[model samples]
Target: MTPVPGDNPTPRPAADAPGAPAPGTAQPAAAGGPLRTGRPKPWHVLWLLLLLGWTVSAADRSVTGPVVTWMIDNGVGFMAHADHPHALGGLIGGLFFAGYMLTQFPGGYLGDRYGHRTMVVVSLLWAGLATILTGFLGGLIAFIVVRVATGLGEGAFYSNDRTLITDNTPPKDRSFGMGVCISGLAIGITIATIFTPNFIDFGRSVLSDIEAWRMAFWVLGAATLVVSLAVTWFFRTHLKAATVGKAALHLGAYAVVSLALIMAVYLIGDSTGLSDLWIAVLEVALAVGLVLFVLVRKGEEVGPVLKDRDLFIIYLCNIAILWNLWFFSFWSVSIVAGAAHSSFAASALTAGFNAGAGIIGFPAGGWLSDYGLRRGWGRKEMMLTFTGVQAVLTVAFAWYLSAADHPSLWVMGLLLFFASLFFNALQPVGHALTAELARPDLRGSAFGMQNLIGETGAVLAPAVGGALRDSTGGWTAAVWLDAGLVVVGFVLLAQVRGRRAVSPV
Candidate 1:
């Protein structure tokens, strides 16, 4: 396999060739300690940027929930007078997943085909714009459209994030870098959980009750846009040599995917007035089309390394795990608010308390993974252990919700803390495993496929959870369903045989 852009070292000219430095004369390093190519320090900066990016990404995506809360109360529902707000909330949440779902495979392929930096820049910019737009849109249809656009950009992001991790870190320390950096996802959620309501409250002082949600979007989106531009400048300025080609082919493939999406829209049947069934079918088509588009391409063929049967099982496991992650991330506040009989603002803060658990979990998981790998203890075992703990906590939380008259808010918050602790840890382990299992050439695609599958579940879980709550008028089924997903993921993860650690790429 030809070395991909991010991981590949620059080829040097022959000693006798033109532009070669004289035998004794040495060149100066970049002002910032060293040239970025092949250096570790620049990655520290990039990791910090990733930290920021992940935080903003999580905050941007979580906006759906806080905004939906306001919409439900303030009569900003799907219709002028909408009913079954939970179901509708699910649809809105699912729409973001729908848009997010399609981009995974293509995004990864693009990163593999082009440069990871390019994808990162584009994702941040797109998400920034979409996040801002989501607040401004009033109608459910318009809201869904903007959220999906946001998803598209965000979908591009995760795969590339891992790719950048894979490119920058030596194999031994990959889990550390990926886990610690991607922990920003949790931190962002925490920030949103704690501050989203506050933003709304501040907005209410100056704006209408309904318009308060718009304020959250405006501030978060504006900040994201500024960060995106800064990231773009830093990458472009430092890595000045990157060139773009393959534009024509990339565009052609995109056209094919777009056509497939349109065809799926018609064939899958009309949306039946924004019903869940309609969106599910449409999203499925887009997902299937993306799968085909990615898998069917020439030279894009994956080798046996990627074809490991265990890989798909792991992907399925990730999907199951992500179902838990997304559902909770999207709706935990609502669940807490209902069960604890607390205010939305208060419950959001309580629910977000779990996010703080990640500050420890992420770094610890990465360190543990690296420790295991270095000692030949294997990354999969460590991943499975954390995931198993997550499954148990998931069940415990579900049980408490069902058994207790009013699940103690403190107990619920504590359970959520542990659940998220183990859950967040599982992610970097999975990423490290992917980095280990996948050939460098296929790393981006592997991550894309993993996220694609995971997000498919992520897209549906919120809607399913919400619909279940709407139908049952209780969160028992919804919370238990999350537990069931964890068990399923745990079982699949257990099936993944730990492979011996490979040398750093």
Candidate 2:
């Protein structure tokens, strides 16, 4: 590829090169030659584009969560029976992830082949349109179809956006860049919490007949369109080409496994009996299949592993981190509301937890990760330490919740703040691990796999929490179960060992 007319063409050593200097280390210049500095060329424009794309993607996906109850209230109900609302809701909501998981490998491969920028722009526009359609339509079939389309569009956006950041940033700074970009995810969710209620209120006040929930969708769609245009305008250049063969194989394999598992579950459950045990077995099988699919794809030699065992351990810690983070998003509000002595207090607690995490914890995590990288501490170590502390805090909070008759809101809030802090810190560490392990050509696939694994927690947490709560008779059991999972995740991290070779900033 020809360099742009004024752009420098001088090739620098790749950050993951055998003996690349650590972030803070200085390289000696050649005798009488200008010093070979390590600072990265500014990519502010690209970073902003990445952030905009990510924020829109995340907002579109999560906005449904806050507005589902409103949708049900406004006569667009999922089912006639109250008993089946959760089951139907789960099925409807899970469809988006089903589509998302289905498309990830293909999206990653497409980004590698066609260019990350191209796939991102296309995905943004596609999802924006689908989101708009979702607002205008009603009924179960329409909801399901539009959700699937939104999933496909969003699946493409996440995979390609990660690839773009990985391709554009130097290795040493990749984690920091990724952290900054994904912080948009946290920001979007936060904005939804703050703004969605007000938007709904405005719609209700102005237009008595129109469902405010529908209006929220319209507004979200408009915002998505604007962001999509911004991304297209700013990220016009294709920096790295894609690889089609590997992406196709990986994508095909996942699709086959997912379809087979879903079919198997349906057939077995619908057959002789619909025992809880049989349903449980089917869910476990589906989960296993998903994991195996990722393992097989990752094992295909698409990327290089950091020689250090510790780096791999760090990755494990990140998986744990993601598990806890998602667990809270799925269950924290429900638990609080269920336990709240008063309905108003419960509402306030839920709002406070989200506000604190989104506003304070997310940015802090990125800042700390960047600080560690700049100071020459291993990013992996930072992740491990933070997650380990999180596990302890979670256990303590669970115990408190279990034992207390009327826990103080202030105390609960403090624990939640700490949990959010540790949870958010893991993002940069995960990104750094990918940067350390992936070869430049395969970075997209590597990051895609990381995201796939991390998000599996999203799929499992709600189901697991619900089951535990049902079996044990309250939210306390669910909290303990989550705490235990976090600890087990820490143990997994303990197995990773080795130091990564530092890359240039």
Candidate closest to the true structure, highest lDDT:
1
Q: How many collisions per candidate?
A: 1, 8
Query: How many clashes would you count in candidate 1?
Result: 1
What residue runs in model 2 are displaced by over 4 Å at the alpha carbon? Answer: 1-41, 69-76, 84-91, 206-210, 239-319, 341-349, 355-363, 467-473, 498-500, 503-505
- Residue-level lDDT tens digits of model 2 in 1-505: 2222111233343222323332212221211123237632433345566777777777777666556534433444454443434334434444555556556656666666655666677777877887888887767667766775676567766766765555555454566666677777766665654466666777687655445566767788889999987766554343222332344344445445554554456446747666333453454456556546555765555434323354445444544555465455544554665555444324434544643464455455656766776776766677678778878888888988878898766677778777766766666666666655566566566555555545555555544555555556667876787788788887776665534444344
Off by over 4 Å in 1: 1-40, 77-80, 238-274, 298-300, 303-306, 502-505
Q: Residue 380 lDDT in model 2?
A: 62
Error of 1 at 249 (Å): 11
Q: What are the clashing pairs of model 2?
A: 112-242, 112-243, 113-242, 113-243, 309-497, 309-498, 310-497, 310-498
Worst 10 residues of 1 by lDDT: 22-31
Q: CA lDDT of 223 in candidate 2? A: 91
Task: At residue 503, give the lDDT of candidate 2.
Answer: 36
Please write out the lDDT profile of model 1 over residues 1-505, one tens digit for every residue. 2222222233333212223321111221211233447754544666778878888888899878767765665675453365678777876787678777777777777877666667777788878988888777777656766677677778888887887776665556678888888888888888887798888888899888756778888888988998888877666532323332342245235534543563345334434355664565467656766666556664347544346777878888977877887788888888998898898778888898677778778877888888877777778888888988988998999999999996888999999999889888878888888876776666777888888877877778877888888889888999998898888888888888868775432
